[model samples]
Target chain A: MLPGMTTRGYHHGDLRRALLDAAVQAIEESGPAALSLRDLARRAGVSHAAPAHHFGDKAGLLTALAVEGYDRLADELGGAGDDLLEVGVAYVRFAVDHRAHFEVMFQPDLYRGDDAEVRAARDRAHAVLRGGLAALPAAAPDRDALAAWSIVHGFATLWLAGALPPEAGRDPEQTARAVIRRLFE
Target chain B: MLPGMTTRGYHHGDLRRALLDAAVQAIEESGPAALSLRDLARRAGVSHAAPAHHFGDKAGLLTALAVEGYDRLADELGGAGDDLLEVGVAYVRFAVDHRAHFEVMFQPDLYRGDDAEVRAARDRAHAVLRGGLAALPAAAPDRDALAAWSIVHGFATLWLAGALPPEAGRDPEQTARAVIRRLFE
Candidate 1:
């Protein structure tokens, strides 16, 4: 919201977006498991009940994050063009850049995986991934998709964990492109 | 230990191991972030102070888990012989069978990453992974290793998260083998 343009009590659609943005920041700093709806409300400069009204509770908030994450991922992967290599690189980049959302989206325990919005968004993201793989020749198409998904997901997860050795160095995306290209060989 | 082999007040070396084992179960059920040392001590049927004595705090216990996880990973990967394919398969197997350890091992923030024991074990594990990649030809061998690591790691992570399509079916190892073989192809 613009700094001084809003009335104190005026409700706007921007509140939800602002609250979700606050959630991403909070989850990034404190992790998904420690996220608090009350704190997010405080961060958003709203009444304690404001976030709960929009999200119902913590799980509800996380469910929204997962859905939003998948939608954003679908956008990124969809925009990566038709090349499987570039698509794979884009997937890793999305995970690294949206670390908090990526974490919640995958860990079903963190949110309701069966939520209608979550399931729909997840399917959309999966479709984008499979669409990118259409250019590749494979002994088994299904298994190939799994392979592509696994390697990129693993790299991003490892990179986030700091489990990968420092050898990859400085920039995750460039190093990821070099690493991801090996699958084609 | 067998149910019948019981003794009261026995201070065997097993206390730490037993506590660590309990931690694995707790972590698997809840998560690393929700881990409680006091609760672990209770589950292990020890004094409340027992867990703290052995681990200092929750981070201390997680640090122990990280060390043990890296050591175990090294053992599995090292024992897979010179074939990098088998080593990758073994890596996924380790993640599935020891899900808790695998989860904590990657997330550096969950424990003390800079501790001497953790750094050494991490190096040993890294050495095992790099050793497995030695059999492959690549434009860049080090990045190839990272690629190899990322794929298997990503697959296992996806599988654990239940993020993979149901097509993966009831058997993770079988599905994982097929996907992992693609890296070699």
Candidate 2:
């Protein structure tokens, strides 16, 4: 429970969620370079060391964010049902919508890779992608999966970085669907 | 020239190359987070300030490396001689061989983005890719070019990040070629 949190007067059953939310806001405004536990605590209206109790360190907080991101991504993408292309589009959508988590999740150097929670969360997300890939035709599923994953991931990553062409005109979700369709064609 | 380096010393004309070489070695050893101009100068047996004379700043040094990388990539892809798939394969090869530059070039925040030299070099590389893409069949050239570039760039980026499956057993160049071939199929 951070000191200045909106739920400061309460025992705040979900202090962890509050911290994570504050982290995302901080990351969005300052980028990953300025992430700080004390600032997070201040923003959350808890004691300066409250974040340390929950996350242990900056890396621990980042690991937690990565885990949450993976879980959310897996849930969103998995819910796309039988449509592999839809799942691909959902993956891109998750990235765009959760920019802060998406940014930290991929930069392995920024988090504790060996943490069991992080590992399990990451594996869960990967399983969703693999599952979606398996839904494709069996003739050359592995290759097709790799191609599909590569295009969607690449496009989403580039688009977030503002490297994609403006003339493409299609929104990120539409662009992802268009690219994934070509993979099967 | 960084501090302790001298035009009158035994290594002057070659010192710039030596410093760049040392920078690559450092990036490989510790990743980009650990890169420091003073550290590079120390490793090169020069004073901390000596690097400034040659590169002006850390961004300048990185920009120089990026410019060199773009030139090398353009040359390699150009040598593929108008075969779109071959050019795509060459793109993957460049990413693998020049891992340091490939990593830095894409991370726009880490370099001097407004430098004319860097922009020119990057544009030259883009021209090579665009030229090869233009050689594809006339129908839907715009979409085809975007797809072709996306697949090759996506494959190379993912492969370099160790996200691709090792059990696939296919070399990067082969995988790149296969992915690109799907565009026309």
The per-residue C-alpha lDDT of model 2 at residue B1 equals 66
| TM-score between predicted and true chain B, model 2 | 0.89
TM-score for chain B of each model, two decimals: 0.92, 0.89
Q: Write model 1 residue lDDT over B152-176, tens digit each, in one string.
A: 8988998898888878876877887
Give the per-residue lDDT of model 2 (tens digit) for A1-185.
Answer: 56644346634447878888999999877566568899999999888877898889999999998888989999998899768889889988998999999878876677887789877888888788888877666566667767777777777777776666665665888777777777666
Which residue pairs of candidate 1 clash? A151-B151, A154-B154
Candidates 1 onward: DockQ, in order: 0.78, 0.39
Query: What TM-score does each of the candidates earn?
Result: 0.92, 0.85
| Cα TM-score of candidate 1 | 0.92
RMSD of 2: 3.7
- Residue-wise lDDT of candidate 1 within A11-98, one digit each (tens)? 4668888899999999898788888888998898888898888889989999999999999999999999878888988998999999
Top candidate when judged by TM-score against the true structure: 1
